[model samples]
Target: MERIKLHIAYDGTNFAGYQVQHNQRTVQLVVERALSKMHRQEMKVYTSGRTDSGVHANDQVLHFNSPMTLDCSSWRNALQTLLPKDVKIMHVEKVDESFDARKSAKEKVYRYQIINQREYDVFKRLYEWHVIKPLSMERMRSAAKLIEGTHDFTAFSASKSNVKGDKKRTIKSIDIWEEGDGRIIFEVRGNGFLTHMVRIIVGTLVEIGLGKKDETCITQALETLNRQVLGLTAPSHGLCLWKVIY
Candidate 1:
């Protein structure tokens, strides 16, 4: 059997999420169905991350084993033909049998975009959250800085998340920049993430940028380890899985 690794990118605007649902459409369901057609059997795949609904991915990785010995080019072409228009196969290659897409992942980068103007663009609605208010970039950056490095992110993640192991993870980097006239982007890289962590964090940062909170409040939020102390979860449509490094 040949174990192939797939690099996939998808626009998750219309799908439920990455994992397969009983009846609803999902990224994994589509990919696996495409692969299953070519293999004449089920082809279970493993992904580095299971992104939420309305989330987009620029570079997501997955792996599956196939008993068929189809050429890589044919395999990729066949899968592409079967997948929906919103999803695309970026690359397909064989990797070591022991290599796991999740465990071998080194880091993940995500970007949350906000439109900080009076009006929203129809085109960017799926990719950027529309916030019609002036935001202070300095305040947002300062608050973001406090969450860097290895620390318990219990305060920033969703209270419902039940992740095993330590919550301590390093924030390798975070870059906040004004993308354009009314757009601000927050790009964050981390070793791992808890469920809804990035969206919750982005929500808090937005509150900070809007002058509702200061840098010290970020520390206070962390110290309290209370979900209610932070901001609401941002819309999932504006979040994108930018990249994954293995």
Candidate 2:
């Protein structure tokens, strides 16, 4: 058997999530089904991380042990042909047996998009969050900078997240920028992320931009580890797993 790593990209609009579930369409289920058909056996695939429903991925990584001896290019082409239009295998390669898609990852980058405009565009509605009120980019940028560096991100995570081991995560950076057309992007890079962490951070920054909170709120939240102090969790559709660094 050979261990194969795949770089995948998908539009998560139709799937329940990246994980498999009974009677639910999911990205993992679809990818595994396509592989099983190509390899003529059930192929179990493991991913670096899971994306919730409506959360897209630009370059998610996954690995699986396969008995098939197809070359890397052949595997990519065959899998793409079998997969649906929304899910595509971007690259494939053989990796050392010891490499793991999840454990071997060193850092991950995520981006959340928001359109701060009077009216939302129909074409971009599915990809970005629409905010009616004008946002203060200066305040948001200030708040974003405060979230950088090592800190316990318990306040930024989902209340029911199953992360039992550690709440402390090292954030390498948090960048907020805006395009002239009112497209605002919040990008975050970190060693690891808690469930709903990026979305909550984005929402909290937006709240600061709208004058609902200030930069000091970030410090208080981190110090208290209080989930109730956080702003609303941004919608999943606005978030994307941009890259995974090994």
- Top candidate by TM-score: 2
Clashing pairs in 2: none
Write candidate 2's Cα lDDT for 1-246 as tens digits.
Answer: 999999999998898989998999999999999989987888899999998889999999999998889998999889998999999888898999999999999999999989998999899888899998989989988888889999999999998898897899999998888876899999999999999999999989888899997788889999999988778899999999999999
Clashing residue pairs found in predicted model 1: none
Off by over 4 Å in 1: none
Models, CA RMSD each: 1.2, 0.9
- Model 2's C-alpha root-mean-square deviation from the true structure amounts to 0.9
Candidates' C-alpha lDDT: 0.88, 0.92
| Distance from true location, Cα of 231 in model 2, Å | 0.8
How close to the true structure is residue 99 of candidate 1, measured as C-alpha lDDT?
84
Q: State every prediction's TM-score relative to the real structure.
A: 0.96, 0.97
